[model samples]
Target: MSGDARGLWVTFEGGDGSGKTTQAELLRAWCEDEGHRVVRTREPGGTDVGQTIRELVLHHRGDIGPRAEALLFAADRSHHVAALVAPALARGEVVIQDRYLDSSVAYQGAARSLGAEEVRELSLWATGGALPDVTVLLDLDPVAARARLDADDKPFDRLEAEKSDFHARVRDAYLALADADPERFLVLDATASAEDLAARIRERVAPLL
Candidate 1:
């Protein structure tokens, strides 16, 4: 948002099975159809370097200390913001990213017992205080989220495999973030139908466009 480009940065935040990707894709397609260039990306794997970092942090077999894991995510975030996210916006494209600093704040800071404020500060420092124009939080119960994941038949990543309590804490942290910044966040219930959710997201994004 702070970047000096005539573009918009929209990010999605939620639990593992919260349908963030689906909604983001929907928005991207709608934007493209409206003649707006759109880039759909995700944290931890938004770039080639980020993909490697994602494997180490989310798919590695061995146990990684909590601090090390947090630092790894921060590292990937730093590179992603500089390499992919910033340039996309600079080109006047609509960047609908799946996650941003909020994920690190929720997963590492709140769920992992690292302070959210500190984690946020770490990311801000890394990115020179870059922030999204708008962030959409798809709210859902972690239990429901887990059930949706179970239905996918795909392997759970490291964080997705965590206990329900961990995810619950993550959700709480996400809601708290939205509550703290109502003007910057558009909170939506993930329980709604995908089409319905997509419509609501479009409604919120229309103004920015």
Candidate 2:
């Protein structure tokens, strides 16, 4: 990548209702306020085609096998990386992806029994090895996360409605990723107040800027 390529790539990751989205938005707004160019996007739906795939992957109640779901997510990532994510990064925009390859590795690999290495290989291939420079994982208890989701009135999607055990495994995978790459992954507790959490994110990201 060129020295002047789009801004640093940061990704938010965690189990559902772990405040990744909330923190991502806060970070994006803060960056914009600081006069930094920022691009906020998400995997499986950063582009039109990817959005279609996202609908199928998240909202659809159909029973898709583990491998099938993995492939579909990969397909969405391919399009998202090529058409949306990569281009933004190339332009030197700070790209904030809501969820990226880590989500796939944790959900499909750890939770669904696909194997983490296999998921990593697929993600590298799909995104052309476009790993995020900084990954912030909002660590939260699985039960707490599900309770937060349940409190919302929106209909739970297929993945959202998964059992607590599955989410616990997913959380473990996230922790493993952070442990495996301490230099790149920043694991933060999710039980903190939103403002405090956002302040932590700002502190962690400010030095990178």
Candidate 3:
């Protein structure tokens, strides 16, 4: 890792069942094996306060407006950064987060009909303008992604139960984010096998490694 950059912050993002967690773990292991200090965490719950917000955001059955959800995610993100992210980065560790600000932009902003640019601005404010060094977005077909979720044993959360069209919009938003930031966004095709997906991510991380 470059000393000047301090630490490399990487985030994995995607819709439900997009294999982000598995891939994040794989990358973390790889980074550690290469002797880089690593800190693995997740958004919506990287800290105690964030986890509380996660439960409400993920499972709450009552109606929540787009702006409200976006702010909640931002609140969780702010706590996550204060409690974990910034300190890890200052120490020069490789910090891999399962999800992050991009999730709010895609799900709440694009999927829920809020504007994408506004969501990005909110994310900047929430995180104190800190952005990931790189973001890996698992680009999966909405139908296949939903099917994978159905096969999982975990109960579906409110967001998971959303209609296909909603998820499709979210997926589009993710792609748009990648397109807007080619230097730091890696779009992995979700159709790839796990092994292939990992390899693709390795390729993307090679420069930083």
Give the number of the best model, judged by lDDT. Answer: 1
lDDT of each: 0.92, 0.88, 0.88
Write one digit per residue (lDDT tens) for candidate 1, span 1-209.
Answer: 45476789999999999999899989999999999999888888999999999999989999999889989988998999999888888898899998999999999999999999999999999888889989999999998999999999999989999999999999999999999999889999999999999999899888878
Candidate topping TM-score: 1
lDDT of 3 by residue, 68-94 (tens): 889999999888887898899888888
Model 2 regions more than 4 Å off: 1-6
Residue pairs clashing, model 2? 5-92, 6-91, 6-92, 6-93, 7-92, 7-93
Per-residue CA lDDT of model 2 for 50-141, tens digit only, reads 88998998888768999999999998887887887778877778888899889999999999999999988998898677778789999999
Model 2 TM-score relative to the real fold: 0.96
The model with the greater lDDT, 2 or 3, is 2
lDDT order of candidates, best first?
1, 2, 3
TM-score of 3: 0.95
What are the clashing pairs of model 3? none
TM-scores, all candidates, are 0.97, 0.96, 0.95
